[model samples]
Target: MILFDQIIFGPIHSRRLGLSLGVNLLPIDAKICSFNCIYCECGFNTTMHDSPIPTRDQVRETLDAKLHEMVAEGQIPDVITFAGNGEPTLHAEFEGIIDDTIALRNKYCPTAKVSVLSNSTRIHKPHIFAALNKVDNNILKFDSAIDRTMKLMDQPVGKHINVAWFIEHLKKFDGRLIIQTMFLRGEVQGEKLDNTTDEEVEAWIQALEQIRPQQVMMYSLDREAPTQNLQKVSVDELNIIAEKVRAKGFDVSVAG
Candidate 1:
């Protein structure tokens, strides 16, 4: 089922939203993201390419045409999410897309939310922060609070990135920030790693409290990953950690 996925792919059932329509802003031939996490489903980044950037007008045109068709067919969705092969924020006209997408949704289906599943690499950009503030939900990634484990798990693009600095930046965002974490056990580069341990989970909770995100979405692998050694954490383990976050008065959801 993997090919060049069109601009919209599901009203596929989602745990949080009943049905979600995806928006793919990156070029279809290769995955585009700042971090090459071992568990990413689109596979790893072989080389960086910058071509075929979708213009704001094109995004509006494609999305409008799809929404019009969906409206006529009465196929309403719970959300219109910015998620796809890679990071949606990488799109040059991200702010424009957010503005246009919200306007189109209001015209066609006002009940549907404009949401984004971003990695939070570009949250430092004032424009990106302002754009994300307009969305109904801004789900950002924060896999591990420890620097050494973060490098092992996320494999970020540059050496300058620090977890502490990222956490600080996220705290200042003037919108609802939903933190997303992927819990798993794996061996990468011949080294064994586990992120579901008590100490690791405690550190993550501390970061959540410091950032004070509006919500948290915790889940494990659901598709084939680039790293085969990674094992999905069980529901029981997820619930134990989730309860700890919930006790701190933060809403948490365990997605399958």
Candidate 2:
């Protein structure tokens, strides 16, 4: 039920990425996402709204000004993040925007990293993959490795998508990407769901082994979920899962 109302909204402290400055390429007044996740902080996708996606030029200009301003205030962000009301990759000019953001970050605060939070739905697209590779931290969502659990959790808008499809494209990263997983328990549409079960965790670990990411980020709901029945996984539980991932000889970061 929360929405960011600006193109350049936050330099807020992020649990995973510190001092994060956000860029919202989607409409400021409404959400535009490929997945209508029950636990999305922005709530369900908005079907109707007049707000337009910002032009490439507009994003460049605004981001440039904001970065310049932050530099002047001696508040250099740790990362320039492409995340907000909805899926940032959905923007037609996403690649060009990443190009612009990189230039601005270099000019204003060269040390700051550039990151994007994506749902991993568009990684197969040539342009999106290229753009993602250019960023410092290409964090992607992989909430569950099981087909049924994933469908119930992510609620992807694309009917053709399945766990098989995700594993296939994700391996394309070739260990260059960061896999982000959210662990939680709840019931949605009258079915019990929990991605933390032994079987679920085991399946997810197997998937991660194949994906071979450079690192893994694990966390639970830090904010209220739209689905009222959802429960947050305890920090201890998260650390346990993180340890399992660590045993696989992969770098893991926990943000609970």
Candidate 3:
């Protein structure tokens, strides 16, 4: 499993966000998440640590030190991203951390954009919603328009989370949200699942029309997914889906 031990780790090149610096708010040794997704690169949410999550002050201090060093070395990142071992919004001090990150970004790397990669499960929280709105890129995951496919792919912690309710809640973001969808096919425990199918794509496009996001980022699996049965959708297939999404009169991009 790939895990980030430092609070501030990568300054790696990303297909979506260039030269991004990553901030990991979750515990260094374990994965603490609200969803147990099958495709998570960090592996399953198996280790639940009781130890206190990184405090607001700790995050501020660590991030400040990193950013200062980068600035001194004349190596400013293109973006400062919140993506680590698990759900960033799950942290008790998430809002405060966002505030700190923005401050650090402004002081050290004014050109860098602040971004958060969230599962959208916690959008119901007022504070989380507010923090997400403050970021330059509020990327939220939307794997499928069908509840059954979502359950099979994401395996959200909350069993009650269905697509209908999810769409209604996601609409709250409106223009600020960037919807990210993963296109893939696989069978888990004898259940066949594929979100790239015509029926699935049509339903998803309908949902996107209602959500009206700033943009849609569709991509296939790039690394080894935790679920071994999954297959990556080709770039050609992703572009085909992107074209369909664009036909609905929304901005769309494919990264495969």
Top model by lDDT, which number? 2
In candidate 1, position 213 carries an lDDT of 90
* Reference-based TM-score of each model: 0.95, 0.99, 0.97
Whole-model lDDT values for every prediction? 0.85, 0.92, 0.90
lDDT of 2 at 133: 92
Q: Please give the ranking of all candidate structures by lDDT, highest first, separated by commas.
A: 2, 3, 1
Candidate 1: segments with Cα more than 4 A from true spot: 1-4, 48-51
Runs off by more than 4 Å, candidate 2 = none
**Clashing pairs in model 1, backbone N/Cα/C closer than 3 A:** none
**Each model's Cα RMSD:** 1.7, 0.7, 1.1
Give the least accurate 10-residue stretch of model 2, judged by summed lDDT. 1-10
- Candidate 3 per-residue lDDT, tens place, 187-242, comes to 97789999999999999999998899999999988888888889999999999889
Error of 2 at 43 (Å): 0.4
Candidate 2 residue-wise lDDT at 103:
88
